[model samples]
Target: MTYTVNCSILLTELPLLERPAAAKAAGFDAVEFWWPFAEAVPADRDVDAFVNAVRDAGVQLSGLNFFAGDMPAGDRGLVSWVGRESEFKANIAVVAAIGERLGTRAFNALYGNRLEGSSPEAQAELAVENLSAAAQGIAEIGGTVLLEPVSGTPAYPLKTAADALAVIARAKDAGAENIKLLADFYHLAVNGDDVRAVIEDHAKDFGHIQIADNPGRGAPGTGALPLGEWITRSRELGYDGYIGLEYKAPQAEAFTWAIRPVAG
Candidate 1:
């Protein structure tokens, strides 16, 4: 029942190095983020400084994503993309090193969007290969590789918990045992999937869970989804992992609802 802030979305008003402190000030002892550097492999000094920021802020680095291209420019991931395999492979060691340094055990690897000319079978094969490699590298530090189902993009293949699990299965079959699903409720609800059913059937399959109300991707109370109930159900079903707050809120006051008791 612990909570972690996804610094990638929240606290954008502060500098990248300062977001961890901002999260701590907002009462979060742990934080997660997408790749903070523009480059896949940044300078050693940059990496050291980032690690220092989290340590100095007294917040634990709970999760981190491998570089997935320019996220703001509509690049979801490169691992499965045909020509980007080299880039994707090059990032594995860097991500593993960072995870070890930060004591982060959860790593998310986005399945890239489908390419225009590539066949689905080709992309699927590549995804399995790259994911297997990622899982192998992360496993060295006793970390798990997370596969997420993102919403609102048809080109992105994994749009449901089942979809992500299937990919995890493929990776495991390929000899990578550390793969697990990252059940992000906002994406599932936004994609029009039954969020509760996913929780009921696959709560035990999830390694991590993230939440943001649907429709607007805002704080829990700002949307009509039964977030409190869903969270309560997840706990009832024995999901003791962190529930990451990965929403966009205009101000800090939007999180007041997080302090409320869970509905029965």
Candidate 2:
């Protein structure tokens, strides 16, 4: 049972480059992050710095998200943002490069939110095209591209596992089988999905998993999500991917319940 800490959210107290080392010092052998750069295609120096940080810290980059646009500015993803198709495609080589260097084979592609003037149908069609391209690009490194179901944003469309899974099916049917589900338990639960049934019937479709307690999105036991129980059950049901600690809490106290996560 390997747990990967999300340095992006957990170790925000430190500089972005320092978080990996912090996770390593916190007894985690693996780490994951949202798209680390501000742009889809960042400068080579920036890319080199990011790749070197993970390597120098001696922790595996368990997963990385594709450029999801200005996250702090409220942009969720670029996979379907009308005319930004090239930006998403351009970001692929950089993602592949980092994966090749750091042995990362799981990549998250956050689906973009709906635009005011664009038809949902148009955005969805573009999503399939971009995802198909992304899957092919990551496939060169034997990586699986992940489609996640997010919560807290009404405009964000994929709020359930089934929603994300359907998009994955469309992308696969478009000829890229490397696309899979990111099964973030926090989002699934927040979106009011039947989390247990999601796992019971579709654990086989999970390419990765992330966790955070509900109500506050805090550490385990801080809320009423029964996160550890769900994670343990996921393992029993055959999801063997790395479990991501993608919660918000005091860095010093976040991993207090990080010991193999067997609910009791």
Candidate 3:
């Protein structure tokens, strides 16, 4: 199986426009990222520059995220938020345009965190509506919409693969047939879910997989998670998609572990 770097977390020291080249320089031919722009819908020039940067770097844009609000500020997602439906809708066209330009097939739509007074049923309904719309737009370019289960954030729901798959099922039943799960091992492990069991049971259902070590959300060796084994098991279970290295490493040297062989 091939590996891809998550430029949003790796090479973050560089500007967004330069990350693709940095990832390329690190011997990665494919890269993924969250929404690079601060705005849900950025200016045309900004979009042009971003697209040009990836092309010029000669790396494949394997995956991208729809706008999820300001990530650094703790806004997990916008689509399922009670009042951000319009913002989420505005971002769909922009995300579709970017995916078409970059030939990215996987788009992750984060489910927003629960609100103070919001009903779980209401938020779930909104998620279904927005994700269905996103799936329709992304499907125009033959892309798949991804739903991920994130951990460590109390307000954000969907902490396990089962949780995400349930939502994906709902979206698919609602006419979004291209939706699938983004199985991030780090999040599942952090939430105390059995990573190996998840892969054994549902690897074939995954559209994409992301990885980081638990406890610190750092590079593989920085923490104690059987990342290499999990990766191998995922492939054994028929998941041939990209295994995105979505970890935090402050320096280039931290990636040296990637060259090491996995223990059997």
Candidate 4:
């Protein structure tokens, strides 16, 4: 299996050009970012230059995290953020173009916050409609959108594996095939669900997996989460996708723990 590093850990300090080298030096096969290119601030970063840097460093660009809005409002998954459908679609198109240039296979698809005066069922419908469009946009370029479930966030709509499954099932029923699930270990831990069972049950629909120790949201060994066991079990469940290390490694030594084989 391959290892990926989430660029969110170094976004504040590193330039896009140097990220690939940094990830390679840290023993990661690929690197990803959480919304590095926002339509609101596209000029702040250069997407094409970042792609060139990845090629020059001989590292793969894994994916991008879609952070459209806050949680609580059930608008974080794929519904809509601030009720701006056109802006959301435009941003997704830009991200997909970046993915295509960088040779990335997946992108994080977030559902925005909950809408005011909207019922839970209504929120789900909105999320599916918007996500289906986003997914279709991504799929045209040979990429997929991975829906993530966050726990305790403002968008508590998809806080569990079961929640993600239900959403995917609905999308499938509606003939949406471009969307998939991104299972984050830290979020799963926070949601208090069995990670192994969740992954096994939805193995086919899972496109990417991310990890961070819960409680502290640090490197895997820094928290109480049983990461090694989960890794071992996931291996058994025929999951061979990249395992993304998406956490704040405050100390240099913290990075060392990332590549060490997990204790089964």
Candidate 5:
């Protein structure tokens, strides 16, 4: 199976700008990332540095997330956030520019967590608008906007494949055909979704797939979540795309699962 390493989660030991080279040295031809900047519209020089890093390292930018507000501080995304529509719209240009520069086509847009005062219905409506805008912006680069079900955050509404797919359908109804689902196995399992059933029912609906084992969200073998079977099932059901390695662990042991043969 082919894979792309998620530099944002795996190579934590290296400086942000250096993870691409580290990923290349580790034998991956492609790497992906969350928004790799503090602000939505980062300074031009920072964008240049990120683009140049991937170029110099000779790896493809397989996928990227549009700015998800302050991830470390618990801001999941801006798409549904009541007041930050401008920031998300602003980041689209930046994301499109970077995707064009690095040949990336898949873009993950994390659905925002539910805010206290914001009505869920309103947030959901706003999400479609933001996601539609994102789809249009990335379309110039032949890009597809990805919606994913995130686990662990109680306020996060998209906790199952059905939930995200419904949103994608709504976005498509609004004329953003480039929008699709990002099937992250770890998150689905943790959220109590039957992943195999999801694959069986909606394989072609996936635009991308990210994998990390449960328990600690580590490499595949670190937990017994049947990730291999899910992966094999995903392929058998027709998910012919890069399986993103978005696991967490120290650099010394993060890829231990890859060293062993994958199970079918």
Candidate 6:
């Protein structure tokens, strides 16, 4: 029930190396970021340098992102370049190397949007197929990929936690164990009919959890939802992994809350 900070909140100002240092300064044990490496760093700026920064900062990397878009509904490389399979596989391989460098083993693989005229079932199958390939590549590098389900607002159609879990289970049945759920509380509260029950019911399938209050998408204490209470309750139910700080920081004051882990 310990917490980790997600580095996406700081991508605007800090260099990649400084992000981990900032998280440590904020009292976090670890930090996470969206895709850290797009190309082999310049001959000047290399992956080892980035990895060393985290070590020097004394923080663990919570997770890394498997890029699915450049911007809102921007080109999702997964389905668009379906024919050029090698490129898609290469994106996943780069993510694995980044994860290894950061001391993290999970990456959030976005399920692509529904294509025009495509059946819902067909879209789900395509998602499964794509993630299966990505998961296999990550597993080879000792990493896991968590499929993040968006309600199609910022990203389309596979918009529910249950929907994502179904595809994840389907992929597992097809012999891929590296695929699991990346549960974002903000997304769930936005789309899910019953949020708390959903978390309780599917805790086992969840590989990681991200939290932000609904509506504002700000820190846990800044929104209308009782996210701090939710975190407390979740720990009571045996969730002992990192709950990522995935929301934007509030302007006036920093949001801080204690996470009390429930003893077994």
Tens-place lDDT per residue, model 4, 17-59, is 6877776766666888767543422652576676678888777
Tens digits of lDDT, candidate 3, 160-187: 9899988988888899999998999999
| TM-score (C-alpha) between model 4 and the true structure | 0.86
Clashes of each: 0, 0, 0, 18, 0, 2
Model 3, runs deviating above 4 Å: 260-264
Q: What is the model-wide C-alpha lDDT for candidate 5?
A: 0.91
Q: Model 2, range 1-264, lDDT digits (tens) per residue?
A: 688999889989899999998888888889999999999999999989999999999899999999999888889999889988889999999999999999999999999999999999999999999999999998899999999999988889999999998899999899989998998899999999999999998887789999999888998788899887888888898888898989998877878876743222
Off by over 4 Å in 5: 260-264
lDDT (CA) per prediction: 0.88, 0.90, 0.89, 0.72, 0.91, 0.68
- Candidate number with the higher TM-score (5 or 6): 5
Query: What is the Cα-based lDDT of residue 39 in candidate 5?
Result: 95
When superposed on Cα atoms, how far off is each prediction in RMSD? 3.1, 2.8, 3.1, 4.0, 2.8, 4.4
Q: After superposition on all CA atoms, how large is the RMSD of candidate 2?
A: 2.8
Tens-digit per-residue lDDT, 56-82, candidate 6: 888888787766555343644353334
Local lDDT at 109 for model 6: 73
Off by over 4 Å in 4: 10-12, 40-45, 67-78, 260-264
- Between candidates 4 and 5, the one scoring higher on TM-score is 5
TM-score of each: 0.96, 0.97, 0.96, 0.86, 0.97, 0.83
Ranking by lDDT: 5, 2, 3, 1, 4, 6
True-vs-predicted CA distance for residue 198, candidate 5, Å? 0.3
